[model samples]
Target: MKTGTNNKFWKYAKIITFLLTAFVVILSGCVDEEQNETESGNTTNNSQEITGTTNNQGTTGGDYIYGTAKVKSIQIVTLESFPVQVQVIAKGYLPDGCTKIDEIKNEGEGNAFNITISTKRPKGAFCTQVITNFTETIPLEVRGLKAGNYTVNVNGVNGSFELPVDNVPEETPGSMSTKQQIITEADNGTSISIENESTFYLKLKENPTTGYSWELNLSQGLNNISGEYCPPEQPEGIKQPLVGAEGVHLWEIKAVSKGNQQVMGIYKRPWEKVTGKEENFILNVEIV
Candidate 1:
């Protein structure tokens, strides 16, 4: 009975040891499986992140790949008391490969500039706002211009358009019309018949310091000719053969007779010592 009990005790101890060893082996295998799952999950997440980053870079880089862009159109809105709008279509393209990135309201010193006009005033006025990487619409006010034709220039590019303004009279307050008159009389001294009366004036310039005097001779056809005559003289009444004014002096002559007669008048500005006649500087008059 003592030997049997001892044998039973040893058999139970061996069975217990076997069970414990089996539990340890199973636990180690489970731990290794868990570690492998965690490492695999981390590798999958890292690969996904790299793919996403590469896709975003490709989309952004493709935008400027071709290196060509165009300005589609330009519009102007006039913001005067009355709103007037104008549209312009651009025929040419802009710099190549310019992709629109962003835009905003602009307020800076170097951005503003002045436009000069050779005429009275500009046909249109406006404030220009700029945009980056994209086409933009501008605004303008039309004023102080005629309702005919006009042009607008941006940088060096030019465009033609029309303006809507009242047609004001071309004559201004200070503007003066030139006056011109021409009178010719026949040789008949008894009765003077006016031949031509045109209001057109000619240029007359003379220098009287060199003993130059204009002579008026009456035609022999008329008699009893008389009128007030003003010979060319200096404002200070300085005699010829001396320095005088450099302008033609005006004179008036008239004649009357009982019978029909012819008269002639000649204006002579002769050299002082020389006997030959000097050239006559004609006068022009304009009629109103």
Candidate 2:
């Protein structure tokens, strides 16, 4: 009877041990599945965060390329007033919708106004591939400039404007005098007499873009005070003058002594040898 009881106890213990082992295995599988699911969710969220950061950096950060805009033309507008007010209108097209005007810089050096127009776009970004037209009107600082022809370059597109008279106000000292005379192309070969120490002006037509300018030859008793070139004036209802148009060269001269003074001008390029076939202007002056 004791041996039977011992066998029955062993059987029941084995059955309980097997049942415990199966239950532990099932519990371990469920825990492992839950852990894997949490890890997968974390990986997906991290991927989204990384992608968002990259896009934000591309748009608002310093990840961009610099370029120049394609300028088609430029219009120089002059206001009719003393100390001329001038503005330049730049017309161009952007290569893509993503491209934008980054900066515009202008500085006057001698007779040229250099304008730099820069553009920027996001790096490695997809954008609309359509061309966008843009117009920028920029005012020029012409308060201290002398009367003459001035050239403007906007992104390599060239245009010119003229200051017909000195940009200074008429009330400025020595700006106007009663002893001054005006000379024009129509006055060529004409004899004129003026008082000693008197001043005179000569306005001659010239086209520097063709490499031709008026070379002046002044005789004794005459002194050249100053000179400047002025581009052609824009007509009424006209936006701008054509590129490479003819302009005027204004020369101020003073009669120093009383004698016969002859003025001669030859239109030719300075680098070329003087040929008699070139155009010439002759003037005779008598200073008393």
Candidate 3:
């Protein structure tokens, strides 16, 4: 009874100081819920390392911005006079999801995208010894590529190359060059007649003096008449009759077509008048 043992030791020291202040307020709410679950698992592992390696996916990394593109340059000049300068460089890469597209060059027929420089020998004709041995082919099309990696730059004269663009297909329109078969014949004749099985012949002679001469006939058979005659178009001292021998005469004959045809020719005045004589005669026919 020392005073009932000091009021039972201050009621067990205020219940052990209120159970150690409720165990430090439940250990500061369990360390603030384990520091908000370790800051939400480090923000979900940094958003899964930015959506696992990004190259346009992960919303862009390499300064990503999708859509809108154009890179075009093409030049080819060959009039063929032969000092031989052939330079052709073409490049076109458009990838931004190709929408409502408007322009793209070099696509003129079958497997379209062409650069041809040919030489059997005779474009401007001058070859002592320069045949370089050339061949070039580049065909490509790009429209709305959205699957990754695209870069192309092609420059000529052997300088500039950087090409790597993938997957782009769906543009078909290329194939042309077929409109060449013109046969026009009209004759009011003092002497002119031609029947064709059709090997190929083009002749126009308007006699009065040599003004036109063009002949192309490779030869097959039956009534083939060769031609040359020109005179009388007046050009100084007017006493002319010697330019393959007489005016308004043009002839083109090629034979190798056989079926039914006739050729007869006659233009007289040049059995003697030396210096370059004139007088014509030809009558060749085969009709069977």
| Residue-by-residue lDDT tens digits, candidate 3, 1-288 | 899999999999999999999999999999999999999999999988876855236334323223322324543322111111223434344322312123223332322233222112222323455222212334334233333332333321222222233224334444221321112123212222233343323233334333433323222454335455534444567574655432344444444454433344333333423333333233333322
The residue pairs that clash in candidate 2, if any, are 148-229, 149-229, 149-230
Model 3 residue 112 CA deviation in Å: 22
Once fitted onto the true fold, the runs of candidate 2 whose alpha carbons sit more than 4 angstroms away are 1-60, 170-288
Task: Kindly indicate the candidate among 1 and 3 with the higher lDDT.
Answer: 1
TM-score of each: 0.23, 0.41, 0.24
Q: Give all candidates' CA lDDT scores.
A: 0.39, 0.87, 0.38
Cα lDDT tens digits for candidate 1, 161-233: 5556643333556543232221222111222232122111112234555555545443432222233323343
Which RMSD values do the candidates have, in order?
24.2, 15.2, 23.8
Predicted model with the maximum lDDT: 2
Ranking by TM-score: 2, 3, 1
Instruction: Tell me the deviation in Å of residue 279 in model 2.
Output: 52
lDDT of 2 by residue, 160-241 (tens): 9998877875676634435366677667789777888888888887898789999999998899999999887766797765
Model 3, runs deviating above 4 Å:
1-8, 22-28, 38-219, 222-253, 256-288
